[model samples]
Target: MRYSILTLATQALQKQQRWPQIIAPEKLKPHYDIIIVGAGGHGLATAYYLSHNHDINDVLVIDSSWIGGGNTARNTTIVRSDYLLPASFALKNFALQLWDSLSQALNFNLMYSPRGYLDLAHSDGELEHFMLRANAMCLGGASASILTNSQIAEKIPALNLDQQSRFPIRGALFQAEGGVVRHDAVAWGFARKSSEKGVHIQQNCAVNKLLTSNGRISGVSTHRGKISANSVLVAAAGGSERLMANAGVPLPMEPINVQAFVTEPIKPVLDHVVNYNAGLSYLSQSDKGELVMGGATDGYLSTARRGSFARLEDTMMRAAQIFPFISNLRLMRHWSGTADIPMDGNAIVGRTEIENLFVNCGWGYAGFKATPAVGWKLAELIADGKLPEMLKPFALSRFTDGALIDDAGIGPYPWLH
Candidate 1:
């Protein structure tokens, strides 16, 4: 049933009992044209585009747990394209553009809010650095500008703008079009649309290993059984390392735990997505008035979906210092997800050593924002057997050839990313 005002009226009159399930269960076939190993946003979006745009309907998406039950649903859904590098900005800005029309395109409400995004600068050096970043972002097709202390104060009145405070706010880089979206809604929308187009989605069915032959791709051996595929795309964020290893290819990435939390519901306090550069913390107010917040990674390697208390405490402390009102709020919930951070603090999206074994992992904590573009480009890559120009710089080959797209310029430290 297509969702609309008329459908809503009919459903209400019918007592809403005729609503169909989002995705129906289907038995897996022994063979498929393409198989995606993760049912997260990126994987599902790729399947959707493969069937919708490329007319390749014989696709299957298998996940260990449930659809979007991984980082897709675990993130604090901040989306932005104000990156300092050209490649990163191009891919991300494409996704940001797609985000604007995603709800209508998928016939689902993704709840995308383009309030704005701010990166606070506490020192003069940081302000100068932000100026350089803003110029790069503007040149790369993202709307960015540097705002002075008074301008930032006008934007965020709750911020601790006093110069006497620790890490005083000096200025900021503002991207007026960047904001947040409903993370799980993206997963569900893509899943429902893909299932409608005859793509298969299997949950609780893990791919134990990648089955390869003669340096080419064959398929995957899953918990249920061995399934055959002409091509396989492993977009399984944190778990990609193990799956790639199964294909005899080593990924230069580390999966580390990242945590986020929300405060109890209150009146609307924050409008724009705010980031404290000195503290390395970020936050935004949800539609429900809950202050959604997150900070740095655990600074170590781990696949566990749990974070250390010390890191959480440090983040909250930084958040409280920036916005004193946070001190009065009680915690609503806290959770963590593992991100396969690359050595250069950037994503690795391209073909592996195996001919037909493609990958779209190592996005770290930025996967949610890049979902639409990654899915679209990955679908094209699989369909045309070529890498998109925007994705070339992020290829696995860059790590070896010293062409690392280190957006953070933090060296080859995945932990710090």
Candidate 2:
């Protein structure tokens, strides 16, 4: 059912008991043209675009848990495309363009707000780097500007800009089109639209093993039953490594825990998403008035979705150095999510050695922003059997060829990415 004022009023008059389910809990089909693993934003979006754009409706999306129950629901929603690399900027900028009109396309309210994003620089060297990045972003058709220290102070009066601080404010790279979106709404909107278009979404269905016939994918053995598919796409986020490994494909990525916390709702103060270069922390004020914040990944790698107090303390200390008022607020809650960080700090997308099986993973911390582009590209690859030029840079062969697309330019260190 389309959500609108008339539907809401009708439901209210009926005592709100007669409302349609967002997505039908359909039974597992015996066969499909394509099967996508993980019902998060990426997989659901892929299914949606496959049916809506490519006219391929015989698709099935299977997940172990409820939709959006994994990293999709645990992200601090920030979207931008101010990257130093050409391919990264293009993909993220494309996703941002999709986010701009996603609500209208899906006929669902996604709550996407394009309220600017600012990355702070603590020194002259950092400012110089940002100036170069801003130029590159503008050349690539993305809006970016350099803001001086005085301009930053004028924009954010509550920020601590004293020289006495450990990391004094210098300047920043600002993107007027960067912003955030409602994370859960993105998943639900895609799922609802895809289900309406004759796609099957099966929840609580775990893939036990991958079935291959003559070195090509034939089907998948799930908890529910065996399902056949001509093509299989693995868009699982943290579970990508294991899912691929089960299919005899080893990935050079590791799962790491990332944590985020929020403060009690207060009057609106922060007007834009803020990132501190030296502190390794980023924050933005949610529409509900809570101060949503997060920090760097843990030093070690693990799939456990819980962080140590030491990391939390370090993040709080750095946040206080930038926003002094944080000390007065009470912590509401904190949570963690698992991310698959590639060795070169870049995403891995495209075909694997196994023909008929495609993988889209290694997104690390940027998967939320790249959802739409990843889906669009993966759908194109599956439907046409040809990789797009934009995604060729991220193919698995890049690692073997030593043509890594390291966005940070920090070499092949996974943690730094």
Clashing pairs in 2: none
lDDT of 2 by residue, 1-417 (tens): 888999999999999999989998687779999999889999999999999889999999999899989888888899899898998999999999999999999999988899889999999999999999999999999899999878988888888889888899888999988989999999999999999999999988888777899999998888777999999998887787887897899888888888899999999899898998895889999989999998988856877888878778888888888999999998899998788999887889999999999988888878899898889988999998989988999998888899999877775768666
Model 1 residue 146 lDDT score: 92
Q: Estimate each model's TM-score.
A: 0.98, 0.98
What are the runs in model 1 whose C-alpha is more than 4 Å off? none
Clash totals, every prediction? 0, 0
Quantify how close model 2 is to the true structure by its C-alpha RMSD in Å. 1.2
TM-score of candidate 2 relative to the true fold: 0.98
lDDT of 1 by residue, 1-417 (tens): 688999999999999999898887767999999999999999999998898889998999999999979999988899998787888889999999999999999999999999999999999999998999899987777789999988988888888888998799889999998999999999999999999989999999999999988888889998788999999999998889898986888899988899999999999779999998875789999999999999999999887788899889988999998899899999989999888899998998978878888998998998899999999999999999988898899899988899999888895989977
The TM-score obtained by model 1 is 0.98
Native-to-model Cα distance after best TM-score fit, residue 42 in candidate 1, in Å: 0.6
